[model samples]
Target: MKLLARLRRAFGASRAAPDGPAPAQDLRLRRAAIPVMAQGTNAWPALHALPIEMLPVVDRPLIHYAVTEALSAGIEELVFIVDRGKRALDEQLDLEVDMLPRGVRAHFVRHNAAQGVGQALLAARHLLDDEACAVLLPGQVTEARPTVLAQLVAQFQRTPGSIFAVEPATPQMTMGSEGLLETAAGDLRLASIRRVATSLDHRPPADARLWSPVGRCILTRAVFDNLEQMADAQSPHTGDLRDVIEAVLRTEPAFSYRYSGRCFDCASPLRWLEANLVQALEHPQLAGEFQHLLRQTAQFVPVNEDLSQAQARALPTGAAAVTGRPRLRLVRS
Candidate 1:
């Protein structure tokens, strides 16, 4: 038994336990993973002209939020897994590395042929050999009060295992994506993850508050072992991280840390536009810019309090309505 384990370690194969030196506590973050040649057209092709990983959010690349969040979580080292076609991403990271907060180190690994999340993680298996680490998706954006990354890390520290950051799903979101997760009634751990299409034409589930996985998580070697098992057995759920998590739940201790914050799905076209609008509204310096644009494009209605979609569109303001529906109403302070 011992001899077989020795051979697996010799070849750098995934062992049930950590093989190499454990990564330092402060270096526990794995940056976003995007395939080398992303299949199909992106939701926002023009915005994604520079790889989706490099798409801009506010004034910086989308990944910057994830990196900044990781740094804020006290993680000093980050591993970004990329593919051959993403050389632009590498160049961007190089230029930004110097500006990184002190004591932080970032490394990029090329997984050009990576087919799924498992393959991507396996590429950086060396870095994740540590006992615990967080994985952040570059394209996913959040507008949380305490910051989702900080909350996730704190949960992982308390729970001491895999922790997934989940937020309440919206009707539009449920209609447009796969792997909508259902959590247990009380404990809030995942109950089941249903594979469904996120098409608006389809009927959205009636659940008022379904917890959806938003791509930020703290992972341990146990999760990697499941990935390895899936790869070895050629399981159908090899690429999707949610499927892998479902498998993990059957064996290990996995917890869902529900956050009461707004999360944006940047992977979808319509949602991406909504996220941009929300971010623009929240930008301290860009408030005036957004107001100026709103005046030109739509009627600006100033309300005494925050109004819902139904209420905002009903009120009348002077200018011509915008190109799209809802007319971009601006609520007054």
Candidate 2:
């Protein structure tokens, strides 16, 4: 009963009532800030080989997925924070979206040099105009059926504080993650967050799963105010936005909405290949044509092999998926 009451207060307040989100214009007027600048490390050399957002995923550019998903969630304005040399992404955007959704607008904020995610976001502060905004990391691609982006936006409309989308992290998938969430006793709403560190042996109670922030958030002006203060103070982890979020949890009350779905970190080679294969296998238009091929590839190799080194390189370039090429199985475990 307490849980029911808590949920009612969160979602059934007079503003939200008993039905859907507040209104279309409430979401349409809001903006989404996507930070795209990343120092490409050799661990994943493909990022440096092409504009990270232009990297092919399921035969489509990565940014296409981000933009489409944002549009689906009713966010009409997008601010892309990019580094100086990364203007190539802007060109791709121009050529890709033939027509912007009714009132949607796309703008770019360029960083003079390579900096951390926090700085990239800070660069887009002018575009925010002191309103609440959504922050989406351009590197991760989520393929949830109902689209978790919509869920995050809905929560923001109802509660309107700093809300982040988090999913349970397996032991093996915890490397290089944003942060883990500590939820209230029996609820998934965030109570605290632990930032990623070089070394740590901490473990969560069995009732609580280690939840990683997947670069999707609804942050209010208060959070932005804190970000400005941190940017001015030159705080550590200011370069990484997750750390900035950790700093927010110190004084502000932030919440987490659990997403039990697939989210791939395309910046990672293994996950990137897996994301392509999974998304391709499920593509509505291409799935039937490629089903046999992908299934065959899944059986050809052991699940543990490093497909990134041997198989991913030998696969046909973007041309194959875009046009046509010799058939080959593409699979990931």
Candidate 3:
């Protein structure tokens, strides 16, 4: 009964009852700010080799996936944190202006220096004026149903505090990488992150959850203050955002939602190929057309065999299975 009551309240069904009475004002409409960060000069080097127009996943550029995810979550505005000399990306965005939904605005803020994630976020501080919450989508390709941003936004509505979307990391996932988190308070407080070789000796508790900070994060305005403090304290490194998040975890009530999905680091060649393959499979129209073309081409010639007997070998398997019919099988027996 208690579990059922909790479920009812979670879905807002309990509030509709006559005896329950309406709850306070709906907090769902708290305007959301989305920042898509892509500042590193070597962020996606593989893409540089490919033609600008052709360097895309399915019909859209890889960055479009992040933008689409944010837009799907009802984000009113988008701020792109780009690095200097990213004119190609800006040109691509201008050419594809039609992709933007009506009433949705897009802003591009360039980082003049090769600063870290925290500094890039600080560059866009002007756009986040008066917004109750903001979402930071670091330039990484992630595939999830219901959209990770949408899930984060819903969590923000439920608990109006800083929230981050995390993915549990396995031994294989953290083999060569840093930023392994150790948590206490039932995974509420991140005690520390394993960033160096010497730190691996300190193992996390068995009951302790090991979470990796996925690129997507939803935070309250308090995060801006944290960023400001971090900027003053550190000389700036690659894990600038990580430092800010760890600091916030110590001082404020930071929460995280575990997301079930794989994130692709486009900075690597292997992951980029995987991301493209996944996108190709997920794209409806493009996949359908590609499959159709393959089938049509297969009708005239076998994809692997010689053209001499291609037609005879390419017949439908069902037709060849008819027992009474003359079967065409090039057999050695």
Q: Which prediction has the highest TM-score against the true structure? A: 2
lDDT of 3 by residue, 1-333 (tens): 999989888886633567776667554533443343333434366545442222466567766677677777887777766655656766766654468878877777777545666677678888764555455554467888887777777777777766667766677656655555554425443233322221334566665556667777665566677778877887454532465465456557776677657777665667777887777768876777666654666555556765445534555575543334343443321
Candidate 2 residue lDDT tens string, 1-333: 998889988887455565766555444326888776644656576766576678889778887788777877788788877766655776776764556666778887778535577667667878884787888876778888677788887767676667778866566655654455655446545444433332124665565455667877777766656766776777765334566576567567777788657788787899899889888888899888788765666675457755444354556676333233334446554
- List per-candidate RMSD values in Å: 10.1, 10.9, 11.3
> Candidate 2: global Cα-lDDT?
0.69
Which candidate has the top score in lDDT? Answer: 2
TM-score of each: 0.69, 0.74, 0.68
Worst 10 residues of 2 by lDDT: 191-200
**Model 1 scores what on Cα lDDT?**
0.63
What ranking of all candidate models by lDDT puts the best one first? Answer: 2, 1, 3
Model 1 Cα lDDT, one tens digit per residue, 7-99: 888887663456767654553344433233332345556654555556677677776776776777777677877767656776777766777
lDDT of each: 0.63, 0.69, 0.61
- Comparing candidate 2 with candidate 3, which one achieves the higher lDDT? 2
Distance from true location, Cα of 201 in model 2, Å: 1.2
Clash pairs of candidate 1? 175-198, 176-198, 177-198, 303-332
